[model samples]
Target: MARTVEDAAGAPHILIVGGGYVGMYTALRLQKKLKRELRRGEVKVTVVDPNSYMTYQPFLPEAAAGNISPRHVVVPLRRVLPKCTVRKARVTELNHDEGWAIVQPLAGPPERIHYDYLVMAAGAVPRLLPIPGLAENGISLKTVGEAIHLRNHVLEQLEIAESTDDAELRRKALTFVFVGGGFAGVEAIAELEDMTRDATKYMRKVTPQDLRFMLVEATDRILPEVGPEMGRWTAEQFRGRGIDVKMKTLLVSAVDGRIELSDGSSFQAGTLVWNAGVKPSPVVRRGDLPVDGKGRVKGTEYLTIEGLVRAFTAGDNAAIPDLTQDGEFCPPNAQHAVRQAKLLGDNIVRSLRGKALKPYVHGNLGTVAGLGLHKGVANPLGIKLKGWPAWFFHRSYHGAMVPTLNRKIRVVADWTLALFLKRETVSLATVEQPRADFELAALDGAGHRNAERPVSENAA
Candidate 1:
């Protein structure tokens, strides 16, 4: 139902969509700055997202490898933004021209929401290709659910390898293949390989040497963000660990776990991780909002949607001008998104006060990625670091940036615990459908005083 709120409520509404990094940060800043407006009920902040939490994505690889607890990597929206109305829903339609958005609740039919202003920061999803069998076999590392599932899947493969009698079956069970060479792909494969190699120590039959790890990339190098030299070095690091770093190769097909590569090679692998790239969120094309050729909401350096009144966007979904470089847009990364959200929040507040909006300018803080526990690479402020120092810097920097003091403390605690204890490797794959045994029991009448009884003839 398209219902309108009466003005008797008094305060103007500001609806924020996509409660990720941008949405959460923007609303937090607004709540503090517009203290008067919020306290006096002069303005209302409502945020709509599919989840009730904002996930800190950088920790996903660690979470998948059992280095960090999955629970610690996500921030609860309701707890973090008490002043903001956090609604769990998916935005199906947004027509800012009429100041209304149609959103479907998590479990219900679509409903319409009218807002005075809009913030589109829904973020991006993994860009997928039409490679055969990828739909059935490929796993992604985007969300916590996917991370947990990957952890279980990897562990289960180890168990399979340990129990299998056939040599080819064991080989297939131990083969792990990853597609893509970007930050996500490299870090994920590295961390996961590290964990699995360690897991082999506990298995009776499986050894580190038995596992085959391969990274398939279409490009000549990996981690282009760190430059070709560093990318080559990173590839060498993986190769040294017995990982097949397949450069200039693409996953042609994976029909029924038969991974066919563009390099005229094929393999039977149990795992396929896709981390090729990300396009902007599909939300951008929903309305008349201007967008670049890439489908990202066209945003000025000021972080406002071009010529859209009271409309602002930031994060991966927005193609905000890259004032730091010529003829380039800001690359969609956590470093940029976190910085832009602060500026976007301030600009939104400034707009409310009818003040001039300032253009966003960010100095590249450089990139840092952890390969495993005590190994990584970092380029912070032009100083290149590798090994343990780089790994420490990577964890320290991300810990400081994971949003909210509570999450920061929790993540730090998770790391602290990892130092004392071995990696957690409990695979709860059956938990996905936990009651199957009970359902089977019911079907077979396994425990039945009533099941043995005949139905009454008088029963309807």
Candidate 2:
């Protein structure tokens, strides 16, 4: 039976799953390309995801360090993709044979929605190890909420270090451990470590040297994106700033806030940050679709899923063949995700209109990274840069890539103002548990008063 366009009012429905870079950008491009078709009720694009906004992940480290406002990094879906139907629901299962999917809505029951076409862009999730207490105690920097939590947690550690008289407790609170040395871990630790150092000047009791910043990587070097020479330079730079870079070190366990490394070293810390790696979301496995060894949807050069004509996949969850490389699949990164999404959108339209589909083939443009203010590393267009020049390139490249004019302008304004104004050192630690301190103090005071009332009653 052909699926009827019920309440879609006779429009051909295009159901897109996931709202990450691929899903959002594909929907945006579709609306622009198929505007005339859409007006004639020929098509209706519906994007379903758990989030209403798409987060720009590159700036998360800066946001965590208070370099930029958290709100500015996320682009609201409804405001940008006004022509499409945005649904805040997660696709629980995909029945490719039936040309429909089971969507679990945020507020209500799961509903089976039929579609003329389907695009899977469900991105990856953090790849966590079996390290003890990691899931419960360690914090991740994947989302805006996690970044904000890290910012608050770092500042709260400073406060605890300042007020506490117990030497062991203070040392543990002041020490910060970052588990991964990749881009996310390196950028986060560098920015936050810089922020904490600057904040210590205002904290009378706290000193910069007193705080311990450690980076533990299972690999031999950090920042593999920039290659070997610059990676070595980066490690040296961190060492100069009093950061302990422990390479070729494996994390044995992190049970009960105690970090035990394979090198026979043990340390107690209140904060543990994990940024090891990522894996495709489990939603891919739930679908009866062809997947790669890594559980990513296997796709051909045209971005169409293998053995499925009406279905397509892209972004981190799709194992699209890398035509640029001889025998390799595309790497999971925002750079490739955005480009693949554009190509996927065009291919979809071509397929629908009976035109020849184009293959996705784009060579990587190299990599860039920011290590703090006026400090960075980059290798763009075969040009190697370091220190201030690299930092400039990092900002310039990302500033141009940020979606929408509103977001681009806001981010540029932030960079411009950061030059003249002193860095903001205030940490909203209380934001996490707003009522904890107050409630604890009130309870303690009430107990003291109750104890005095018994003596006063006896005397009376």
Best by TM-score: 1
Q: Residue 299 CA error for candidate 2 (Å)?
A: 1.4
Candidate 1 residues 93-179, lDDT tens each?
A: 889999888888877667788888789999999898999999899999989999999999999999999998899999999999999
TM-score of 2: 0.93
Return the TM-score for each candidate structure: 0.95, 0.93
- The Cα error of candidate 1 at residue 36, in Å, is 2.2
Off by over 4 Å in 2: 1-10, 434-460
Prediction 2 global C-alpha lDDT: 0.88
* lDDT of model 1, residue 452: 44
Instruction: Give lDDT: candidate 1, residue 38.
Output: 81
